[model samples]
Target chain A: MTEMLRVENLRVEIKEETILDGLNFSLEEGVHVLLGPNGTGKSTLLGTIMGLHKYKVSGKVYFYGEDITDLTPDQRFKKGIFLAYQLPPAVRGVRLKDILKKILNIDPKKDLPVEIYNYLKSLDLDETFLEREINYGFSGGERKKSEILQLLLAKPKLALLDEPDSGVDIDSLKLIGEALRKIAKESNLLIVTHNLKILDYVVPDSVIVLLDGKFVYKDGLEIIHQIEERGYDYVRRLVYAQNLS
Target chain B: MLKTYLKEIRERALKAKDKPAILGPDIDLEPYMRTIEETPIDDLEKLPDEIKENILYSGITPSENDKAGTYFQINHSVVYEKLQEIYKGKLEIMSIQEALEKYEWLENYYSRLIPPDTDKYTAWAEIKPTGGYFIRVFKGQKVEHPVQSCLYIKEGNISQNVHNIIIVEEGAEVFVTTGCLTHLKDQPGIHIGISEFYVKKGGKLYFTMIHNWSEEFHVRPRTAVLVEEGGVFINNYVTLKPVKSIQSYPTVYVRKGAIARLYSIIYGRKDSYIDLGGRLIFEEEDAKGEIVSRIIANDSSKIYSRSEIIGKAKGTKGFLDCRGILLSKSSQIVAVPILDAQHPESELSHEAAIGPINEEEIEYLTTRGFDKDEAMSTITRGFLSLEIPGLPKVAKEQINYAVAQLEKAGL
Candidate 1:
């Protein structure tokens, strides 16, 4: 099997405080989930991979056999790496239609392409919402829907989704899962989620449990089902037992 | 009597008092006044054809079959006018000289909003202006096409002062777009525009003014609008080129159930000092007002944005939004927004922010596909965008064209 992503001793620190310490993981072309308790550096790991300057990282991150540790967020984006942020910035005076136009590099005088309108229809969003300001006064579910919509348009090779189901309503979550389900067929998805309910709609091929910024278990989707049934405490016992050995 | 008013204003202009602190003490009024006296007005036949062709750029010049009226001014004089079929008998578009000689009703609105006694600029205009335009829309008639005007400077080492009066009678609506430009070779001249607008009860007036002058030009505009009950006044001002200096503080008065919306988008570059703002006075109950300013300072420019809203009656509401972006560290932007509420039930609010364009937003744009320059252009467009729901579609397209031109010119 070919390795899609390889992290060698990844360490992240933010403002003199260590968030992720010595995390090493490798993933192939498949759907994967990172499960951990609250404040266990799940988001930090994804942010480090996405090249956010908020954290200082010391590690080697290789994608498809090439080192991408020092690449910029935008640079990685051009190379087919996309992150659907949990909280997108509310940029005043920037409309959704305008942003989409810039992203797609369409002529300003032309109407939006039919493909995007069709994608929006599947999400049940009004086409007129394109004229409204980006993320301004948007509800939680609406924000999530917008991120997923961007993902569908971006068409990345490696997708890093940070808490895509946390604040989303059940209906939005189902819709998001359906969209990601289609995306996972072509992209290697690393979903950082706490809610295991989305797994019912879009099942992952592999599940990795993170403990204190370290991956403790590497197994198939059955491990995720086990963790869901027995809760995180069972994983904690296994994590501590493995660390002691 | 007019001579006495002129003498008073000339004396005052010599030693203008209480000038804003931002203007500093280095301002010398002697050069402008001297230029006004030394320069001679040119004959119409001797002028270049560009003076008339400039009106074509304003998109207001009437075709052979068109009924929309137009007034073109060259060196402070109205050189051409076309009040066609629809506006022939009912509407009146005349030079200030013609109006003073032909109509007695002009006295009721002339200088009523911005009197010659209001300031030195108005006073000087009263004393020395060559010519101007006087427009009166009949009561209850909606003017579908915009009345266009152009003020072009053809002479060097001179000053041009023109007074413009616009009156929308009761229940009437009119749109006016003015272009103020000077020749590229103008040698250190001054342009002072004094305009007064009156929107009668239930009337509406939409006005747009675009300024493009040479590097050696100094511009000073004095304008005021008075809206009666249930009236509306919308003003849009855009200046996207370099000039020596510009100072304007236009004002509007709102009556019961009336509204005043002021929008200004300015680009200051190449050592230009631009101080632009608006003042809204809520003089009656249930009045509303909003002021929005977008200032972009590049090179060594300095920009000062001012907004003052005064609520004197109950149930009045006002808001001010000021945002500035600086492209260079040497450039400066100062925002001063003041709110005065005398009545307990009146309310006013303001929001202001000045900074360089955000690196994160630029990076976010790049994540999609845009390079650095494209990202910056996109962000600049977003910063200057305004939500003008009631403005005409042509005005919006003109704004987009102006912004694109500015961007292309490396502003």
Candidate 2:
């Protein structure tokens, strides 16, 4: 099997404060979850991998066996890497339909494929929502569903979703999980969320623990149960012991 | 009737060089006046091929069997003028010169909307006004397609002063989409356009003007709309290209139960200075007015946007909104929005905001699949997009397409 993404010795600093400290992460494919407590660098890790230039990153990021450490966000997009922002900025005049067609590389005048409408209906969003400005005055659940809708249309090789399960009701969260499950069938999914509720609807193939910007452990689906039943304290102790060793 | 006003305005034009706060800076027109006098007037037979090219560049080429109506004026002469049989049979459309000669009653409406001595430019236009159209839609009739007018200037060191008058009779509807363009480079020219629109009782008139000028063109456009009881006037104005300097303040007067909406999108490119604004006044009870101005200052350009809404009587509503976006560090945008309600029961509101394009929004677009330039264009297109209700489909699309091309070419 080919490695989809690899991060080697990744260290990130923002405003002279260390965020991600010497983190090493590897994922082959399929749906994976980065479950960690708040204040950890889960979102920061995703942003760095997506080539946000604000953070001072000293490490190498490889995607599909090629070093993509220096690529811009636009370049990464062209190379089939997409990030669903947790709090996407509101584009005052750019409509959701316009950007959706733009991401699909299709003419806005042409009819969007039927599958998109189907996905929208399944997500409980009316087609009229496409004509609205991107994320402007949208509810939290609407924002998440909008992100998921873009992910479905983008069909990227890898999707990094930051906290899709947060700030959403159970129904919207379930819809997002279902949408993620549908997308994971064709592409890779790396979800960053503090909560473990979404896993009930669509379980992850693997789970990684990020604590204090460090990758503490990586295991199969079994680890999700352990982390949920007991707090992250046990994982913190394990990481401390591992570092001491 | 003409002598009394003409004598005073010409003298005012002669003495006018500066000193109007709303008109911004002034330009010396003596040199251009001489060039314009020496040059022969261009008619259809004497027109050069470049005029056709400019017409095509403006995205609408005249056809032999064209529908609705089409009018073109170059410099001080009418080049191509046509009123489709359908429109001509019902409405009266003719050149300003022809209309003046045919109708003696037109003298009343010539400058009623904008007085001759209102500004230096208006005085100049009154003294040496040239090519413009006169349109009157008969009472109780609705015209589907707009009366298309193209005003183009080519030669340098000249002036194109035009006066247009449009009157929609009671219970009638009419629309006009005019394009002012100059393709020449380094040819210093001054253009002053005076437009007056009169909407009678229960009538509606929609006017759209798109200006595309070169870097050396100085433009001064004065416009006014008078709406009677229950009448409506919608004006959409945009400038998508570079210009030396431009100053325009359009006013709309709304009467009892009438409404006026003025929307404008102004773009200033390198070294360009633009002062664009709209003013609305409610003179009678229960009148309504709204104004929206979107200013995009890019590449060291400076833009001044002013929106004012005033209510004179009770039970009136007025709104004014001015928004600006600066695309470059050197560019600047100043927004002045004022709302005044003299009556105790009248309501007036205003909002003004000026900000630069958020870099995070650009990156957000890039992360979605657009390249840097594409992202910039998308953000700009969205920033300037204001949905003007009842705009002509073809005209709206043509203007939008031209704007998109301008954005792709980087302002």
What TM-score fits each model? 0.88, 0.93
lDDT of 2 by residue, B265-359 (tens): 88888989999878889999999978988888889999988888888998899888888888889999988888887899889988888887788
Residues B116-138 of candidate 1 have per-residue lDDT tens digits of 65555566676567667888888
What is the C-alpha lDDT profile of model 1 across A168-243, one tens digit per residue?
8878888888888888878889998888887876778788888877654677887776787898888888878877
> Among these predicted structures, which one has the highest lDDT?
2
lDDT of 2 at A33: 88
Poorest 10 consecutive residues by lDDT, candidate 2 chain B: B35-44
Which residue ranges in model 1 land beyond 4 Å of their true spot? A9-22, A53-58, A211-217, A225-245, B1-26, B33-67, B183-186
Which stretches of model 2 miss by more than 4 angstroms?
A107-109, B1-22, B34-47, B56-60, B64-67, B407-409
Report the CAPRI category for model 2.
medium
Ten-residue region with minimum lDDT total, candidate 1 chain A:
A100-109
lDDT of 2 by residue, A126-228 (tens): 9999888999999999999999999999999999999998899988988998888888888888998877777776668788889988765888888777777
Candidate 2 global lDDT: 0.82
Quantify all predictions' global Cα lDDT against the true fold.
Answer: 0.79, 0.82
Q: Judging by TM-score against the true structure, name the best candidate.
A: 2
